[model samples]
Each structure stands twice: as structure tokens, then as C-alpha cells.
Target: MSWLVTGGAGYIGSHVTHAMCDAGIPVVVIDDLSTGFAEFVAPAATFVEGSLLDGALVEDTLRRNGVRGVIHVAGYKYAGESVNRPLHTYEQNVTATLTLLSAMQRAGVEAIVFSSSAATYGTPDVEVVDESTATTPESPYGETKLIGEWLLRDVGRSAGIRHTSLRYFNVVGSGSPRLFDASPHNLFPKVFDMLYRGETPRVNGDDYPTPDGTCVRDYIHVADLALAHVAAARRLDDGLPVERVYNLGSGAGTSVAQIMTAIRTVTGIDFEPTIMPRRPGDPARIVATGDLAARDLDWTMRHSLEEMVSSAWEARRQAGDTYPR
Candidate 1:
């Protein structure tokens, strides 16, 4: 049976699709191409262009592909932008997830790996976040993710569906030069786009209570993150024990200033980032420990900061004018 990956044409989803394909796992990708690129999908996988909001289409894709499990990566991912568009966010993330789950149930798909977010923690008071950290999401995007998790939990309990939710912050770097992050909301791509056009990158709020007076956040390689999803899927396929949740984190933090420095070093361009006022509700630091994932899913920080920067920069440069502005 094949595995269905929702949003498999998106950045992180495409990486997971590549990893699953590399692992010899048959994959079926269903994406609406809303923010995802159709060309980003792996050539080996089956691609279905549709939205999860269409329960009929989702169910048909799953049954027709003999899908045994799902990797739910499709959702409204921008936490900041979600604030102004709460209803839209709920429709895309929460309502869509509900529809997907219902479709999965109808299709007899009994396994899933959800792409959750650290935004569920919402300016956590603790220096480092763990799975036990209370979820107090401040944005509609985060709340929808938490609601998705709740849906999974309730379904798992009632329907005996095996599932796990992976919580993470920033995902960077590329495993293939042909694949690149095209999100306008993400930091790495945003900076790379600015540099591509000879525009100065801006750093918001450099006066935070971090080591370098800038916000410290967790950043993990997208390729490495994709591997964990494959591992988790394997565990489920083999009927092995799996946790309800895992944090694919770095167990350390990287400051914004440090990232800028790495970008300068990688690009071999000397340009100071323009310091702008801190955006409201910006947290000083939010990192997580991936100890559980390390033990169960072979999770590790395989790529260094410089490698992350250089790989992402290379892919962004390769995309050139082809990437959507």
C-alpha cells in the first residue's frame, strides 16, 4: 500500500516525499498548489492536484492509491499572518484537517504523521520547550494546529488509528539543488530573495534579551526533518511502538544575529542587516530538546549552521527567476 502525503508539493512536504521515495516507500501526493509548486513534487510519486477541503476528492485519492497511511503537511502555516485572517486560517487548517481525517477514516487509513508547530507553545516562558510544555497558542494558525492534534488524538482513541505529531520551529536547507523553499513568509528564503535582488535584509528587534540581543530560535535542516518522518512512518508500518508526539528540534538555539552572520559568510557578501523595530509579541527565545525523537526516530542535527545557510542559498540561487516572487 502506498502512503498519501498531503501538501507533498510544498517545501517540507516535498522533502518528506523525496525521503520516502528514497526509502523505497511508494507515495501519493495530493496538493492544491495554493502555496505549493506542482514541479516540486517527486517524479516517482503519484501527484493529485486538489484541496483537502474536498472530502470526496481526498477519500477517492486515498482509496484509489491504496493508501495505508497519511503524512498531513497541508495547512495554513503562517502564524503571524494568521492573526489578521482567523477565519481563513481555521478553514484551511482546522476545517481542512477535519475533512482529511474523515476521509482517512472512510478510506480505512489507520496511520498518520502530522506536521505540528512550535507556535502551539506561543511565547513559552521556559527557555527550552518540550512535548509536555503547555500549549497556549497566541495565533489562529497555532490554534488550528493544536486542534488538528486534538482531532488526531480523539480519532486515535476511538478508531485505533496509529498517529504521531511532530512539533518543530524553523526548517531550513535543501537535500537537492532542484528543490528550494519558496515561502515568502519563511526567514531563509526571504533573506535569500532580498540578497538575490541586491536588497538589504532586515532584522526585526535586535534588542531582545538574547546573547546577541536578538531573538534565539530553533532551526533544523529540512532534509534531516524529512528523515524523521520516514522513520516514524516505518515504525507505524512495522507495528512498532511510537510516541504520540515528537519534537524534531536542535536541543539548542541560534540567534538571529548569528544567522545573519552565517548568511554573510556563506554568500561572501558584506552587508549589515537593517535593524527594525521588534514586531509585537516577538519572544526572546524558543528552543526545544529532541531527545525523544533522537531515541525513537534517529533524529539529530546532521547539518551545521553554515551548511544550512549554504545549502539553502545554493538552492535559492538555482531557482533564480523561476521561483515565484
Candidate 2:
């Protein structure tokens, strides 16, 4: 059966696309190229340059490709930026997802693997959040993701739409040798860019209630995240359930300072970062419990910090003139 992966040219989506293609699955991609690269799209998959807001286009694409499932991964994802542009967050993430779901209803495409986020949990009192954790999103971006999950849940209950919403934490590392996160919003790419220019990466906050006082996040390699998606797809194919929500993460918190140290260790750069005030809407530490993903999808991450950092560094170097320089 054919599958449609929205935003398949993006970093995480591209990795999923690669994994799907490698498994000999027929895949179709729909992306507007707003923050994604056209070149990053897998050549084996059919690509349609469009927006999720276009309901008619979405329906038509589904019907034409005979798409059996969809992996929705299109959305705005910068916490600080989402706080500033809440309207943009609602429009692209919430509204666009509703449009896509509506189109899915019309097309009768049931199974879907939504790309949710750990931000949906916000800053909890607990160190690690699990699937059962209450979703009290702190930022507009997080709220939008929670809204997307709600859409999936409500839609499934109302209509017979089967889905899996994979809530991911801090997604680090590169997917392919060429496809990298070129977004200015991400931490790893920004840090890599700074170090590449012989400059020290800026530390946003260094006074939190953590070991090093830096904001700590659960870092999962992009490839590991892709494997989780693949596993979810297989589970749905086995006619498991109507809806599932899994937390894809390492369940370990890695501080920003730890990440910087890893980068330095990988690249041998002794660049010292300039500590700045905490960016608005950023929580101190957000890690995952990661039990549901393992139990439900039989998924686990296997990339070390050094390996992840080294891959990202190499991808950054290859991205040289290809990236928006």
C-alpha cells in the first residue's frame, strides 16, 4: 500500500522517508519547502509541492496516490519563536492539521502516525514524563502539538481513523549524509554553525536547578526516532488499534553544557560559549520516561552522545555551501 509522509523533506521527516523507502515501501511526500529542502526528499518517493492548508490538494493527493496511511510531520517547532508568533503556531500546526484530518476523512485514509512533541508535557515537577503524564503545554508550539494529538484522538473516536501519535523530545543528530536540520531554530545546528565559524556557541541559560544549571533535554538521534516511526507503522499494519500515542526518546536528560562538551570532544574545539539569560518559554529540564514506546512499538534508541554529535558535525561540514549560506 502507498503511504504519504507530509513534510517528508524535513530533517526528521526525511529520515522517516529514508527508512520507509529502505523497507521497500511506496511513499509520497507533500511539502511546501518553507523550511525543508527539495533536494533532501528521497528520489524514490513521489513528491508534491504543496501546503497542508490546501484541503482539496491533500484529498486529491491521497486519492491519486491511493495512499493507505499518512505520517503527518509538518509544523512550526521553535519554542521561543512560537511564543512570539502564537498566531503562526496556531495557523500552521493546529489549523493545518485540522485541514489535513478533514481531507483524510474525505479520502477514507485511516491509519496515521502523527509527529507529536515532548513540549506537550511542558515543565512538569517530575524529571521524566511518560505517556500517561498530563499534557499542560507551556508554549504555543507545545499547545499546538497537544491540540494535534487531541485532534487525532477525537477524530479516531468520532470516525474509524486509526493513528499513532509519537511524542518526541529533543531530536538531535542527522538523518542522512546529506539531509540535515538547516533550521535556525534548532540548538544542535546553531551550535554547529557557531563552532564551524570558529565562534563559541551561546548558552541560553546556565542557572537552572540542574547539575550544571543548564536546560536539560532528552536527546534522541534522528535515525532512532525514524526507527520508532517504522515500528509504529508496522504495528498499525497488524491491525492493532485505532489510536496509539508513544513517547520516542532516550529517557535521559542531557544538559546544554553536556551537549557543548560533546561537541568539543568530537570536534576538538575548545571554544567557550557566552552565557546569556534564559530564553523566554524555556523550561529547566524536560526528559521522557520512554516505557510506552518500548512496550508498544518495541523501539529503543542506540546512538551515543559522541556518535550523535560526530554525525551532526560531519553533516554540518557537508552542508557547507549547500545549506542556506
Mind giving the per-residue lDDT tens digits that candidate 1 earns over 1-325?
Answer: 9999999999999999999999999999999999888888999999999999999999999999999999999998999889999999999999999999999999999999999998889988899899999999999999999999999999999999999999999999998898899889899999999999999999999888777899999999999999999999999999999998898888788999999999999999899999999999989999999999999999999999999999999999899999764
Q: Per-residue lDDT of 1-325 in model 2, one digit per residue for the tens?
A: 6899999988989999988999888999999988888888889999999999999999999999999999999888887789899999999999999999999999999888999998888878787888888888888999999999999989998997888899888788886679787878788898988877778789998999899999988899998888888778877877885336788777777999999899889998888889999887677888887787888776787889998998988899998966654
**TM-scores, all models, native as reference:** 0.99, 0.96
The residue ranges of model 2 lying beyond 4 angstroms of the native Cα positions read none
**Error at 77, model 2, angstroms:** 1.5
Best by TM-score: 1
lDDT of each: 0.94, 0.87
C-alpha lDDT of residue 226 in model 2: 86
Weakest ten-residue segment in model 2 by summed lDDT: 241-250
